[model samples]
Target: MARIRIAVTGTDGQVARSLVERSAMTACDVICIGRPMLDLSRPTTIESALASIAADVVVSAAAYTDVNKAETEGALADLVNGRAPGLLAAHAYARGIPLIQLSTDYVFDGSKSTPYTEDDPIAPINAYGRSKAAGERAVAAAHPHHVILRTSWIYSPFNRNFVRTMLALARKQDEVRVVADQIGNPTAAADIADGILEVARNLIEGRNEERAGIFHMAAAGTTSWAEFASAIFSASAERGGPTARVAPIASAEYQTPARRPANSRLDCARLSRVHGVSLLHWHSSLGPCVGRILEQGT
Candidate 1:
């Protein structure tokens, strides 16, 4: 049997990088492309990038992910986050390849008392969320074999994510005030990439096309932003890293250009049941990430 060919966009982003690495390690032919070479700013580049890739599956990890900045840069965000995936969907659909696009949990307004389901009504509270929501709609309308995964509180060992930021701050400051009110699970980027590959395997192996849709792919439990910070600092401490006290504060205490969903918790039940993929608990996934960062001397 021939090996599967997987093409992943946004090759430089943490999520995309992890997926590419995993794909390579698993013996899959992975074509990972990034900006300038595969510029998402130019909408036509999406199709052009995938044209000669000879891929059986396409994972779109590219996006304008600067959330706070998106408030002032709405048009650019729309171009990259909204329109690009739609174009990719068109190309993937034409090639009969499954398109797996990463999304965010910001699509919800945070009013839901529990984690959000796939069918939950989308009401983005900020420009970033709006752009992502638009991207989801575009992919859904343009392609039949597509999976839009909405993940939140994403942190990885390699990226400029919350974990990294907390560790840096803990070293520099005596105390860091983190938002205690905002709640969501901290998803490991590696776990998310693995989950995506699992889904892609099913899709490429003659699995049902009906499996395509929006799915929440976060870890199993939920915690507030403050609690999450504590977890990061605790892990860092255990790893002989910084261990500054993380002070709890309300979201209002920290001001930014855009508003954040108070509760970014996503209901991943549909993802687990439909794909039959179980992700590790948030804490369980933390140590290895920390270990990797330490090994790399980050």
Candidate 2:
């Protein structure tokens, strides 16, 4: 059997890096494209990049992820996060290939007390969320075989994320302040990459064709920024890494240019029912990722 070629975007991003790393363990050939080759800001490069790569599936993992910065740079964010995936979906549709487009929990207003389901209404409060929501609609409109996997609080050892930020801050300061009101699952990028590979395999095998739509993929548990920080510190302390006292503060106290969802928890029951893929608990998944970061001093 021939290995499936999986072309992914955002070569420098955490999720993309995870996808590349995990692909080595499977029979899939993961090709990562970014920057000059496939710049989201320049949509013209998208088709050319896809045309050059002979991929069985396309994973649109790249996005302008600066939540606070998006408030002022809405145009660039919309181009990269909102419009680029749609362009990629169109190309994928032309090639009769599956396009797995990553989305965000920010699409919701986080007003619901319970975890967000795939069928929940979307009311994005920030520019970044609005852009992601736009991307979701565009991809769905462009291709029928598209999967918009909405995830939250993505972290990894390979790139800049909450885990790395917390650890870096811990090294410089004895105390760190984090927002307590906001809550979400602190997902590992490697876990998300694993889920994506499962979906890619199913797509390549022509299974679960009816499951081509939106689904939530996230860690099994939830926590606030402060709690998450404390957990990171706890894991770090266990490994003789930098540990700091986490001070919990309300969101109002720590103001940002963009508003974050108070509760970004997503319900992954649909993903389990449709794809039979379940991620590890956030706490359990954090350990290895933290350990790797500490060991690498990254």
Whole-model lDDT, model 1: 0.86
Q: Candidate 2, residue 8: CA error in Å?
A: 0.3
Give the best candidate by lDDT.
Answer: 2
- lDDT of residue 199 for candidate 1: 87
Against the reference, the lDDT scores of all candidates come to: 0.86, 0.93
TM-score of 2: 0.98
Question: Candidates' TM-scores?
Answer: 0.96, 0.98
Cand. 1 TM to true fold: 0.96
How far residue 195's Cα lies from its native spot in candidate 1, in Å, is 0.3
- Which one is best on TM-score? 2
Q: Kindly list the per-residue Cα lDDT of model 1 for residues 104-191, writing each as its tens digit.
A: 9999999999889898899999999999999999998999778989998888877678887877787688799999999998999889
At residue 102, candidate 1 shows an lDDT of: 91
Residue-wise lDDT of candidate 2 within 202-283, one digit each (tens)? Answer: 8888854687999999999899999999999999999999999989999999989999989899999999988889999999
